[model samples]
Target: MQLFAIGINYRTAPVALRERVVFPLEQIKSALQALNATWGSNGLSNPHAGLPAETAILSTCHRTEIYGAALTGNASSMQASMDAGYAQCAARWLSACRQIPFSELTPHLYTLPHSSAVRHVFRVASGLDSMVLGETQILGQLKAAARAALDAGALGAYLNRLFQHSFSAAKAVRGQTQIGAHSVSIASAAVRLAQRIFERLSSQRVLLIGAGSMIEVCAAHFAAQRPHALVIANRTIERSLKLAERTNGRAIALASLPARLHEFDIVVSCTASVLPIIGLGAVERALRARKRRPVLMVDLAMPRDIEAEVAQLQDVFLYTLDDLGAVVQKAHTQRQTAAIQAEAIIETRVERFMRWLDARRGAPAICKLHEEAHRLRSAALARAQQRLACGEDPKAVLEAFSYRLTHTLLHAPTRALTQAQDEERARLVQLFGISA
Candidate 1:
């Protein structure tokens, strides 16, 4: 069997492309089932006809990756396929699933096999791959992905173990290293950017667009500043109410944003919407109403909740994900020493996981050996019981039982050793731990 990870990340593709492939939380389970069906069969149950019997997908704002294990197949064929490019089949599946052209998506794809896949996941789980270095949010996002795959029945032994190991590795990285020290989350960074424009957040009105985790975090950060007012707008009023209750803010319908746009001094938006929600026209009207008063806008969405044209408005300071990336990059450099230490920890865990994987490959042989030993022992025990029932002396019966068990256990090794050539004889000697 071969383990692999195939996908694209923020490091590989820009937000424009990454957003195209994102699997929303509600769709992840169905996506996994579809992927499993395309791979043909379960490799664990029918090794010859399947690829990636076990599969899990990690889809976050920064990346969408498929981690899987392909069971018994033609070694040469699989190797040749890997050499040609290991990600083609999976990438094709993703393109079809996400409705993107393979040609357009292939350039940004990365395919890592076996150990590389293991190491890549370990690093990802440990926050080594996050845009904001050492951010803890991705770890939770990955766990949610694993849980979704499990619910879909797509996760098998290999993937289950891999995710468990990755989680433990992440815990170790967090507990043993200083990678998280003084770390800046994207939400806090947005707040920091807003602080740059407004002398004090206490005097500014803040509006959060969307009720997702990013927006929730931003709400908490802004609330701490005791903003003049905090409002949460969401497609669902229930969701907006829930978030607003927690942040001690007011809930508003997302449809009312344009009418209320000029009311807030700062706006932060992150949503699953495919198209931009805030347009230039709305902002222009809002600006005119506010007498051209400056407003800070941060678009944390992948495809961006704010229109690109909105950034061109003179009275508005709009920041997209790429802008936040640049801001976080400066914080990432300060933790280089801790990150180096964390990488070392991840490497050790990767080696340990690979060793466990290698042992799993020999499981069939080990099971067969166990079955054979059990058969011989049972046969010997039965004969001893028969002899005793036939009225043999107790002492003699016991001695005979020991003799029979010992001879039966050593018979095959003895015969093989006696008839073996020099090399085979030496191997037998070592295998059976012979005296001479």
Candidate 2:
């Protein structure tokens, strides 16, 4: 059986594409079972009847991926079957639940096979392949995906080993390297940049535009400064209330945002909405209401919660994720020392893992060697028993058995030495450090 990973992530696909393919957390197990059923069985035969291959699906805001090991099909055919199955399954699920077309979404898909897939998974778990480098959230996300796969009965030996290695590698990197040492998260960096505009975060009244994980992280960072007031606004009141309760802040419905916009010194927005949530007109009105008070705004959403034109407004400092790139870049040099240490650890682990893999690969040969040895031992014992049965002297029979066993053990090497060419014999003599 061969191991493979297939999927797309924030690096390879845009949000428009990602959202279309993203699987809800609730459906992941079923999705994995469906995929395994489709690929493991030949079409003419029972489509879902074969021993289902080991499979797992990992879907998050940043990426959606599948990892599996199967016995019958080659990589190409398996990948094609997976893609086709996913398209059909995704189409049905999306139409029934999300009202999206899977066909239109297929163009943006990416499929990684074999070692590339393995490398991609390791890099992802290690945070080398994230949209935000060294982001810790992806690690937890990966763990959750692995758990889901296990629950679906899709995790078999190969995938189980692969993921265990990946988890260990991620931990090693985080513990040994300074890659995640700096406060480079979009939220934290946004706050830092906002500090440049305003002298004190404590004096700033911050308005958070969403209640998602990113928004909560930003709110937590901002809360440490003891901001004057923090307000969370979300499309869902329950989500906003949950986030607001954590920080002793207040929650507002999304409908109330336009009216309440002008009361804040900073705005950090990240929403899952497909369209811009905070438009130029809203910011313009907010600016007017604040009597031209400078507002530092950060948009962390992929589809962009804030409007692009908002940047053009006077006395309004608008920053998108791209704007925070400079701050994130500044930490790269600072993290180099940590990265070097981490790479050394990764190298050692990689070598150990490769040795393990090589040992597994040699298992069949080792088994054959054991079987041959057992056969020779049994044959020698049977001959000794026959001599005893024939009333031969016990001492004679025992001596002959020992001699025969010694000859049997040494015969192959002796024959090879005798049959060797002159040059080969000379090399063998040299290898044994024997002077001719």
Q: Which is the leading candidate under TM-score? A: 1
Q: At residue 71, what lDDT does model 1 achieve?
A: 75
| CA shift of 270, model 1, Å | 1.4
Find the 10 residues in a row with the least total lDDT in model 1.
Answer: 41-50
Looking at model 2, which ten-residue stretch has the lowest summed lDDT? 42-51
* 1-436 per-residue lDDT for model 1 (tens digits): 7788888998999887898898888888999888877665322234443356688899888999999877745445445555443466678888988789989999999888778899999999999989988989989998998999999998888988999999999999999999999898888889889989999989999999999889988999999989999999999999999998998899999999989999999999999898889998999999999999999999888767888888888989998787888888888878999999999999999999988988888888899988998998899889889988999998998898889888988898889988999998988888888767
Runs with alpha carbons beyond 4 Å of true place in candidate 2? 41-53, 70-116, 193-205, 209-213, 233-246, 251-327, 386-392, 404-436
lDDT of 2 by residue, 223-272 (tens): 88889999999989999998899988899999998888889999998887
Clashing residue pairs in candidate 2 are none
In the order shown, what is each candidate's alpha-carbon RMSD?
Answer: 3.1, 5.9
> Candidates' TM-scores?
0.88, 0.71
| Best candidate according to lDDT | 1
